[model samples]
Target: MSTSAKDIGRLFSPLQIGSIVDCVEPLSAGSEAGWALELLAERPELEVVPIERDGAVLGVVSRHVLEGIVESAWKRFWQKDLDAYVVPARRSVEATDYVDRIVAVDLADVEKDDPGWYIVNHRRAYLGIVNLRTMLEHLNHLRSLDLRRAGEMQKHLLSKKPDEDPRFRICFYNRMAHEIGGDFYRSTQIGEDRWLVACFDVAGKNISGALATSALGAIFACFKLFAYAGEAQLTTGLLNALVHEVNPGDVFVAAALFYLDMKAMTVEIHNCGFSPVLAFIPQENRKIACKMARPNLPPLGIEDRMVNDAPQLIPITPGLRLTAYSDGLTDMTDPFGERYGEERTIEYLRTLHKSSQADIPGLVGTEVDKWIGESHLADDITLVDLRFL
Candidate 1:
């Protein structure tokens, strides 16, 4: 739940303003008016053309203005000076100006108060004028295409729910944002009463995060395969080691791994910079807090040395319900600019505990939806709920 402004910024990156350069043509002021007509004839797509000199954009001439002036008295008023038509490069749009840089604002989120121009780079000595109307139209087209791809990605990545078990009631939900994201979970039954429940959030978004999560999934298969292959090693150290071997970079994942043994009535958990595993067991007069005892475990695949604490042990009693969720839930923000954080999550669990319900995960999601006021999830959401019968 320790999210940052950078986190939300990554999900909706904008298109570069320099991408519109193809619509402009640079020319020198010495060029004859006939050359402008030739340029227009050769490329009729451009609305306005800039005339440059010594690597600096000095002025521009638009076809609309050029057509109007040429057919009017200006042709006679400046019959001797044809170069008088060139005008200074525009520095204001709707009377507002902005510095040049890679624009990181999402096109859909732009406001009427925003500046009409953005310079994407300084590689060129001088910046040119921009047709704000045409640029925004292009952005709208790209946004439609991107949303379509995101929809397909969501359908392809959401796996079918595993079969129901008589020993435990399981409810799982995964919701992708408008763009593909890096949140996933897995549930594996190793034996009659042995299961592994894992959920992780890769510190990435969109295509990069999706690829990283897919690689991590392959590593997870190796772990599950080895466990059934009789060389079983269910340690966070092993997970950390495998990631270190495959991924030696700045990126890492927040994960919580749980091993449930019904026969022994115990749950062993490894919390690697992941949110504490939350569980509530109804006792005669009080609610037991089975949240991970150590909450400061470091995330996996970061430190060269082992940072995750050893797996902690917890005794399980009858009527125990637990929930595992990604940081997306806690990062949910409201219209009032408040995050639906851990404190509210704990309070929800307390309420669910009192009700003794089986749909803890589903209700938690509903609570978040009500708080955020929409189904358009800004971040990926994943949740898992289990109740020991």
Candidate 2:
């Protein structure tokens, strides 16, 4: 079978500066400047030629420098040794170094008059040369490839849909504003009749957010393997402490946790800095009543300890539906600079509450699509729906 895109992304090798190193032949320091000028004229691709002495690369001579001397009517200077015109290769790097590490090096320290090139070396032995511009372009290409790989991995994690159950129906929709995002969700069966569903959003966008979400996924996986009695409040507290320990000071997680106990016929909702959980109850005369269970605590990773707050409890009656989403859905903006605010979102959900044939997540996506028109999403969007059978 042919490998898929995700497999191809995972198969990519780590990029290194050695991959771009150019093994151009070096010129002897005793070579005449006229000979170097002739060599440069014959080969237009040679931007800079390295000067060597005693099997060691000393410096480089550019074509421009040679032409400048010739244009100034210095015919006698052309026969002199290239030692005086050699420009020292101050920026040198090991060939084995990762391409990403180049960002940490101070490019501003290099003299503007010197040609932008780096001498590639291995164990203090000169290997080849790498042009500064070519290195930067290679770095960009590597970053793009790495981002696409990350996006694929994140997408794979989110693609796992909850198993079909006889007790309830669960459906969700997720769309990243960029190649990767901070929004994520998970569903796990903790017991024969107990199930846990969670939605989370990490602060920031792209790489920063993606990094935090990756940590969140790892924590969740570990929590699933070993949890104490599968208690919602305890799990939330543990998640908070662990998230705080793993993430940096600037990063935090907004989450909504729903614990479903089929035997007890109830749901316990723990909302921490996330959007309110919307509960819909079918009323008389085909009317629908909606209740909002707002967040009771601050976001995770903001503090080492979770506050003493009780999660909201609701009876799991038939025809009752629960919805949870990330703030990205409400923060979506139109071309006219108007937000698809909470009020509009709630109002739109009300219309879907009475329609039994409606694909809830699909309808929500359609409405947001219409509202935003051609404008891009301001952040990652995620919506999850749980309905009692």
Candidate 3:
């Protein structure tokens, strides 16, 4: 694919590549292989460079290629030239064929997209080069412009706080370590004085996990119709099967689902590989850890078999508050690199309970912020506190 000088000039005008044009020097084929190897060794960052002769590109040569060529074809490569060992660069981008090396895009098509490197040629003759490193930096700059907008959308997807219910009350807190993360929770109300809460944490921390949890959160929005949260076995098994079939990865979602039966005065909890659920009873004057009915069962996407597992039942009497949260709280690191583990978390809860801090969820978030001083949070934080009247 050849380009006329007029077409090439038009692309240069659109790309404005003048600022980045002087970053590299293309090596000519006639140059000594020994000197080229020395230059490569001096600048460890430059793995490969363009090889041209008579203003025509032969191919690219890396340190490995140069060394291997010298070793295998000793007579041809070790003497003075790189002709025998210069391997062709595979097409890494939208490049045209007719090449000894990869030509990501021709000058005529440069305005179409500039994500990868381009072969700047005029009438099929090599002009200087447009490199991949500078192009990728430009692409990343363009990509970062939209992350704040995406964060706003993530915040909007969170379920509303539940305060209007006559039988029970809930306070929720969620904070992302990064601009967006995989932490999410949903609370729904079914009729007959019943309610449900499901807290989730996807496997990873940043953009990839955020995307997975965002999609999973959408599937969970279907439960807002009012009955799925309390149906622990059906909800867990269905979500397990659904995530296995839809999500394409080894990563899984760890969740604790709680179903509150105001009529029966019982809270049925399903803890699938999540941090423990703390039961705060003012009457008992202690925090009871309802760890899980089956602690060894894998997270939502591990195996295809989970029929025998069931939710644990606890009597829901006056002054009983059930708190479920993400592992981020327990695993939070201080500036000194010490972990704020389970013991600290439980003690914090007991202290708050003793002090009669009515809003435990909000106070817990504040404590986490104070603990993670001067150090960035390692994961997303989530907390859901359900107090039965």
Candidate 4:
């Protein structure tokens, strides 16, 4: 059976241009046009034939031009030397060049009417010819496959549902700027009355960001195996150290970790270069009060040791609602280039708390949609809302 297009793409995806180079015996100098015509007639597949002199490529002549010359009653042209009909190669590229890079840059200028063949050489020696059109089609197929797999991996990272609790309700909202992004969140119930809710934003985007989040997920899973107690500081320190160890110096994670204890009526928050955590407290006067918990430490993976000594503790009331989000929400810009500033985010939360809306995350997304209009998001967005019932 013949190899399919998908198989060809997969087989040659990681190779260089030399891997796909076509080796056709070239015509030597002083050859007549009739010899090239006869060769084309025999193969019936070659679109262009190369002419070589002293082991160096002179240029190529298309079958269409040769056929036109013969049909136009130019009998003397066939007897003439082929050198006069050869079109000098416009450009030549090294065979060692990566197939992907060639498709991305070199083939960008190739047109349908232009000759789709490229002269490939290695160490200043002509190796063979490469069909730009075929290479582009194969690489495009490979890219599509890779993007689909990355999207699936991202979906798997966010597949788990938040832990269920009668005493509290949790909701999450996330949207990636691309098919894969850096924003992620996790919820784990360690005790009957204690729950850990965390959100992270990796400094990288696309595959790099997705890979970092995957590492975080593995670390979190290992942390869950230990017995549960009030060790938020130690856990945060361990996470910081591991993140720093796994990623490069420039890559870091902005995160917010919330440890909720229904029994103690308190929530411990650790903010590391993340957006402020909003706390809405219900007052006795039948009104709502809002408070902000700003970041107290640098982002994770930036230092060998955790900077913040301890987390900020907030008293949790029956009607208290805790909201945490990534900076993408506040930093998002409109089509006219105006940011949806932090002040607007705070004011919107205050108004949202006063209302009886149950779907807080959904409402926030709708409001953001209105603010951005048709403009695409520049970063990933994630928002988590927790309410003490």
Top lDDT model: 4
Model 3: pairs clashing at backbone N, Cα or C within 3 Å: none
Worst ten in a row by lDDT for model 2: 1-10
Indicate the worst ten consecutive residues by lDDT in candidate 1. 93-102
Instruction: Give the alpha-carbon lDDT of every model.
Output: 0.61, 0.79, 0.65, 0.80
Query: How many residue pairs clash in each candidate at the backbone level?
Result: 0, 0, 0, 0
Give the winner by TM-score: 1 or 4.
Answer: 4
TM-score of 3: 0.64
Q: How accurate is candidate 2 locally (lDDT)?
A: 0.79
Off by over 4 Å in 3: 1-134, 159-164, 190-192, 225-230, 284-297, 308-310, 354-362
Candidate 1 displacement at residue 34 in angstroms: 13
Q: What digit string (tens of lDDT, one per residue) describes model 4 on residues 1-389?
A: 11222243433334577667665667876766666788777667678788887777878878887777677665644445666677777568776688777777766677767756778776787766767776777687777788789889878878877776888888878988888889999988767778889999999998899889999888767656775454678778888999999999999999999988778888999999999999888888988777889999889999999956756998887898998889889889899989998999888877777555467767888988998999989999898888888
TM-score-based ranking: 2, 4, 3, 1
Tell me which of candidates 2 and 4 scores higher on TM-score: 2
- Residue 89 of model 4 has an lDDT of 70
Clash pairs, candidate 1, are none
lDDT per residue for candidate 3 within 276-307, as digits (tens), equals 87887554445444332334346787667566
* lDDT, residue 353, model 4: 70
Candidate 2 error regions (>4 Å): 1-16, 28-46, 52-58, 63-87, 91-103, 111-115, 223-228, 307-309, 354-362, 373-375
Residues 98-132, candidate 1, lDDT per residue (tens digit)?
21222223344455644243222234333335545
Model 4, backbone clash pairs (residues 3+ apart or across chains), number? 0
